[model samples]
Target: MTGKERRARIVELLEGAQAPVSGTALARELGVSRQVIVQDVALLRADGTAVVSTSRGYSLARDARPCRLLKEHHRDDEVADEMYLIVDMGGTIEDTMVNHRTYGQMSAHLGVSSRRDVERFLDDLRSSRSSLLSGITSGYHFHHVRADSEETLDAIEQALREHGWLVPMSDYEREALR
Candidate 1:
């Protein structure tokens, strides 16, 4: 099959999948090398496909409906505040998403729900001497918080906003994306 056709199939397969599908699995299905699959995914993303890379593997971002929520907090509170909020709401921090005015989309895995999960993730980061995006972004960050439903997610957003932890997405900022 041509590269274009193969890329289309890869996107279709990812969108239909409910879970992360490994590059090897995709390569097998497409009768191509895993590297080819990765290249195709990159092309697809460059063309504006919402493909998200998770720790487990790759999945279509649209396949996982992003819960409606907003959170904005100081860089200093990123660890402790995230842990308390996710645990209090009985949800997990699926990912951290940030919109760069000049750079477009950027995100990372957070994958946490409990205090222990938070501690372990933080510990791992420290042990690895790893740095986060915000560390390089002048302390600006955002998140794609997931929960059971819109209501639950909204509740968390509201609480955070009330506590001066979240900043509302202004009409101008929302319009800029369009």
Candidate 2:
């Protein structure tokens, strides 16, 4: 199929998908290379399509949620607890961001919303030899969380604070939460 036709097909396929669609799967179905699918996806986003790339793959962006940036600190071993606390309080851990003296700001997608998701994320990090961003900044970092409501977010903040994970939001970091 032509490139335009292929992209149309991609939108159709993703529209009904129950889960994120992998680029490899899309490429195979469209008889194109994965790189081409990636480019096509980029072009789609450039055209204002709401496709989000998750760890699993690509899925259409859902309606925006009420999200907040929370600063937290903990040891490496306490990572799972922090994640669990947020998810258990009806918060979806959208992503994590950290500022580096050298790299400026760095971020990564987490998409963690459950204990299982936290476990998987922890396992992947351990098995991949990747270090947490918090490690770079003395256990200080931020999480963008989508909660069911402001009450839920308040509860999450309380829990994090009670557990001694809440860090004071700095003036430099406050603006970025928006």
Candidate 3:
């Protein structure tokens, strides 16, 4: 098949996927190398396809959930709690962002919508012994939380507030954190 046809199939697969599909899996399905799948995904993203890369794999943003920006702070050990609170409240932790003095803004895709996803992420982090992006900025960071409804977002915010993890920083306050 031509590259254009392969890309169209990739989009179809992502759109119909129930979970994040891996590059290897896509390549196998498309009868192409994994590099081709990766490059196709990059081109799809550059062309404005709503593809999101999570630790597990890639998925299309088919739901179009409303997103709210939240600033939070917690100990590294409590990252799971912060993530669980959101996913438990029917929200997806879309990504985490931190502003570093040198790096400006850096964000990591989380796409965590359930406890299982949280556990997997925590496990990987533990195994790799890698520092979190927020650790660069002293355990303070931001998340673009996506929820099925506004009420769900409200509940997640309330839960975070009660958990003492919500920092609620304004534009000026965020600068102060740096």
Candidate 4:
């Protein structure tokens, strides 16, 4: 199939998928190498397909929802706890971002919406040599959280505050985000 056709197939697969689909799986199904699938995904993203890559694999971005960018700080060990709290409060952790003095902003798609997702993320972290993105910023980071309604986001924010994880954004961050 042509590159264009392959990309369209990729989008179709992502849209219909119940969970994140791995590049390897897509490559095998499409009779191409994983690198080709990766390149296809990159091209697809450049074209504004909203493909999200998570620890498990790739998926399409969800429909419009109330989202909040929350600044938080915590120890590495508390990662699971924070994630669990957010998911339990009916929030989806869309992504995690950190601002570095040199790097400006760095982020990753989390797609963590359930307890299973949280456990899978932790497992991936534990099995890999890499560490959390927040580590580079000394545990200070921002989570892009989405929920069905503003009330759910408010509840998640309150829970984070109660856990002493929510933090005030710096003036620079506030301006930069805007």
Candidate 5:
């Protein structure tokens, strides 16, 4: 099949999928190299197809309606604490976004769907010796979450705040939540 046809299929798959689709899986389905899949996805995005790329893979950007902001503050060290908060509230960390005081906004694609995903993500970071987004921010980070209700999202925010993993919206006031 042609690249265009493959991309269309990918978009269809992403639209129907309940979770992010991995690059390897997409490559396998299309009988193409993973790099080619990546390039195709990029091209699709460039054409404004609403395909949001996350660290886990690709997901179609289709929020049901009524835009909601799920805000939370968390110290970097308290990742597990925040993860529990999300899991308990029937929410998952959709993405991790950061704003460097110097570098503007930086984001990492973390499609953390479960506790195991969180653990694997952390383990990968450790094994790869990757650098944290901001060294100065005292373990502070933000999560874009998807949940059934606003209350659940608020509960996550509250839990993160209680654990001191959450940073206040003031000071630098960088929005960690989205």
Candidate 6:
């Protein structure tokens, strides 16, 4: 198949998938090298496809939900609590981001929508001895949160605020996010 045809197939596969599709799996299915699948995904992204890369693999971005970017700060010990609260309140923690003085912004896809996902994420961090991206920014970070409606997001925001985890965004952050 042509590159264009392969890319289209990638999109179709992702759209129909219930879970993220790994590049290796895509490559095998498309009869191409993994690098080719990676390049195809890059090209698809450049062409405006909402393909989200998560810890497991790539999936078509879910745009049906309303999302909000929330700035928050908390100690490492509170990570589980924060995640559980969001998921329990019907919000999906899509990703986490931090702005560094030198690097500007860095992010990682979380895809944490349930308690199980949260536990797996924390377990990975422990097993790998990896620090959270927010650690570089002194616990200050941003979360891309998605929920069924504006009201759900608002509830999550309020809960965070009540927990003292919510931080008011700096003017620079506001402008940069815009």
**lDDT of candidate model 1 versus the reference:** 0.69
The model with the greater TM-score, 3 or 5, is: 3
- Residue-wise C-alpha lDDT for candidate 1, range 1-178, written one tens digit per residue: 8887897798888878989999999999989999998888866654445677878779886535444435365665465775577668866675665567777756666667788888887788789988766665565566656677777787877777776767767685444321
Q: Residue 68 of candidate 2: its Cα lDDT?
A: 75
TM-score, cand. 2: 0.66
For residues 38-148, write the lDDT of model 2, one tens digit per residue.
Answer: 998875653334588998889988745677788888999999888988888789987777777786666677789999999999999999999998899998888878877
Residue lDDT tens for model 3, 15-110: 888999998899999999999988888656533356888988899977677777788899998998888888888998877778677876666677
Highest TM-score, which number?
Answer: 6
- Per-model TM values vs. the true structure: 0.60, 0.66, 0.64, 0.66, 0.56, 0.68
What order do you get sorting by lDDT, best first? 6, 4, 2, 3, 1, 5
RMSD of each: 6.3, 8.1, 8.7, 8.3, 8.9, 7.3
Model 6 regions more than 4 Å off: 1-49, 52-62
**Residue 36 shift from truth in candidate 6, angstroms:** 19
lDDT tens string, model 6, 16-111?
Answer: 999999999999999999999998886665443569898899999768788788999999999999999999999999888888998877777788
- Candidate 5 error regions (>4 Å): 1-50, 53-60, 65-76, 170-178
lDDT of 5 by residue, 1-178 (tens): 8776788899888988999999999999888899998888765643335587789989988755222233344455766667766777677675555555776555555667687887888888789988565444544445567677777767776776676655556544432222
- Off-target runs (Cα >4 Å) in candidate 1 are 1-66, 69-71, 101-104, 170-178
Q: After superposition, how far is residue 112 of candidate 4 from its true place, in Å?
A: 0.2
For model 3, state the Cα shift of residue 107 in Å: 0.8
lDDT of 4 by residue, 59-158 (tens): 9986668778899999998999999999999998877888899987766778899999999999999899789999999999987788999999999999
Of 2 and 5, which scores higher on lDDT? 2
Ranking 2 against 3 by TM-score, winner? 2
Worst-scoring 10-residue span by lDDT in model 6: 41-50
Candidate 2: the clashing residue pairs are none
